[model samples]
Target: MNQTYTIKEKTKQIFVLLIPILITQLGMFSMVFFNTIMSGKYNSSDLAGVAIGSSIWSPIFNGISGILLAVSPIAAQRFGEKKSNEVSAVVRHGIYLSVFIALAVIILGFFFLNPILNKMALPARVEKTAFDYLVGLSFGLLPLFIFNVLRSFIYALGKTRVVMVIMLMSLPVNFFLNYAFIFGKFGLPELGGAGAGFATSITYWIIMGMTWFIVKTQDPFSSYPVFANMREFSWEKCKEILQIGVPMGLSTFFETSMFAVVTILLSKYSVTTIAAYQSALNIVSFLYMIPISISTALTVLVGYEVGARHYKDAKQYSWLGVLLAILIATGTGVLVVIFRYQVAGLYSNETAVINLTANFLIFALFFQISDAIQATAQAALRGYKDVNLAFIMTLIAYWLICLPVGYLLAHFAGLGARGYWLGLTIGLLAAGIALSIRLIYIQKRKFTHIQVKEVV
Candidate 1:
């Protein structure tokens, strides 16, 4: 990157990074999207089961992946520093750390899954389906975590299109597997909602294999020698990753688990309620990828500039990325409002489910606006390595504010799912405003430090 860039130049760079990441994000999310749609079609019970199962696992998956996400910015900064050896070492270590984290999740999962489900007290059929789904899904955790490490490393190197290609390649395979396994096709036994988990696991392994193969044989990555000539684990290097990663992972967990908690709480309502919420959530999550993709790009762009001591360039990327995200979100949010009913109908044919989902999307507008701003700002903060504070703020926002307010409104106020969304909107608004203000303060402090050093 140049020492400085114009608005047009920065926008172009952000777009270049954003588009492929967007496609990859969508492709990855569509796996769950397909699962929800297919499960809903099969039966409301199946849909509710999948919804419950997804609520339990998505947070875990994302929190772990969020830790792995640190590899991107870490690698990006090193790449910006032009330290090839450091970059390669971090990538290899990231792969190792993934296994360690995955193992912990597996062990804890064995001890905790049953207890958590029992606490939720879902209907018998739904509980069984959720349990079976998670158990089947468990088989692919190791490969999934490993793939995420490679993905972060590669994306940090600006090889996003490579990941996009591999994700797209896996989509068809996932679709086929879901079809075959869910319906007992091709001699596979029918597993109903649980099959989606197994299908997704198989897909995870396939994509991981593809990514590993590409990284091993590809042009520049081939030289990284990520897999070959392994070196002894460095405690210091691992600490460096953990120091940056843990807070990030917790922040993600706080945000995602808030929603997961809401899902479990909603289990007390009818199956239609659970299915409708999940359906609407899938759309919300799909649209969220728009901003989150920009956020990921900002991490790479800003981290690169920060690493190169170009604070101004990093600031430029930060503002521009957030601006781009808000613009797109505004447009999409409006469109969702305009077509809420039509969009809701896409998820289910039941009139009650459709009506409730449509209303949820109305509340979703506020949620998306706040979320788009905050998500971008949060990602930019990560680029600046300003994670610890962000984590604390996020916990307060989601747990102390969001869940409490949401629970009261949902149960006490009798607003049902809409009440929870209202609480979420308020929480995201708080987080977005706080984080955006902090980003500006960080930029100013950085420049002030630079000036002070010059005088000294």
Candidate 2:
């Protein structure tokens, strides 16, 4: 009865923790969906431009975000150990490092944007549109980077509500900006697809500014100055941040590169097909965040448990997180199955896009479950300061397995985009199983060691 009740409690706890995050995740998805819709509303070229812009820029942004994410687990572990003051230093250094990295991206993006877009075999109209968007977005990269660093600090402190709040506040701002720019409302120039990028760029700075305000005024334990002190910069701190962040950054590159490469391959099919793929991918990305939120919670929980030397509890919390992820994922899968058509229709009206996306959702349903498991397990591993394995696993899964299989299935087998998704599904399944077993083994070993030490 006690075990059953404990399990029930964990379920309730996870729901409480993750539901808000899911909402926040949806809000984030709204940012993507809204941008896609705005572009699509204008014309196919507009939509294509948005897709191209994302494909080109997302990898760089994702890689930088991954690097900064290293701070969360480290902060969580330190916070768990009751070293609360230590977190301030982590936040300070994280901001400095993220800014430095963002500046690098800015420089590279400015120099490479035109050449790269020009080289792509895109339509002249779409290339011009995409280039404008890319250049506009490049300016906001620093704001996004700084915002993400602050957000990571919030996540480390188990204050996901702040993210949800910021996302909520940003929606109206984003929508208004989209209207003002895309359609030339409020005296803004009608920039079409390029307007979508411009609005996003402007919104990013506002969000960053607002986020900084909230962190400084609202979050009590976070003591970093709104503008970082130049004196706070240190070689050791930057190196430490990079030590934890670089592997994560590389892992993101491996995963995102696989997706981007597949998109490039799929582009050969038809514009309609690529559009359908992006639509489905957008929804899948939102669904995947359910587990991601759980993982965030688990990172804090497990790290706290470990730092406190409560080995058994740490192990239990990891299991709790995994179970929570599966249960929530299964529920989400059912909803996707039931409302697949309706969901697809929300983003687009074309019969082909709706049909293809519905089919993709069928695969996406299964994909989410395994993806959740893998993400949660990986989060547990992060709590243990075991990120190196994630780097190895992602490389093997995405590059060695997923990418190759996707290429073969799409090209040689002539199965098209569905084949590419199937390859991703297989890769996710492998990662799920591998990560789960590894977490269980490592946690058990740690528990046994704790027991022996207690005996001594």
Best by TM-score: 1
lDDT scores in order: 0.87, 0.79
lDDT, candidate 1, at 383: 92
Residue clash pairs of candidate 2 = none
Q: Residue by residue across 1-456, what tens digits does model 1's lDDT show?
A: 333458898888788778999999889888988887787777788889998898789888888888988998998898888888888888888888988887888899899999999998799988888888888888889899889889888877876889999999999999999888788899999998899889999999999999999989987788786786576788888888888899999899888888878887888989988988988888898899899999998998888887777777788889988888889999999999999999999989999999989988999988999999999999999998889888888889899888889989998999987789999999998999999988999999764445111332
- The local distance difference test score of model 2 is 0.79
Can you tell me which runs of candidate 2 are displaced by over 4 Å?
A: 1-9, 222-230, 268-279, 339-357, 409-417, 446-456
- Model 2: ten consecutive residues of lowest lDDT: 1-10
User: All candidates' TM-scores?
Assistant: 0.90, 0.88
Candidate 1 residue runs with Cα over 4 Å from true position = 1-4, 37-47, 122-125, 187-190, 264-279, 348-356, 407-417, 447-456
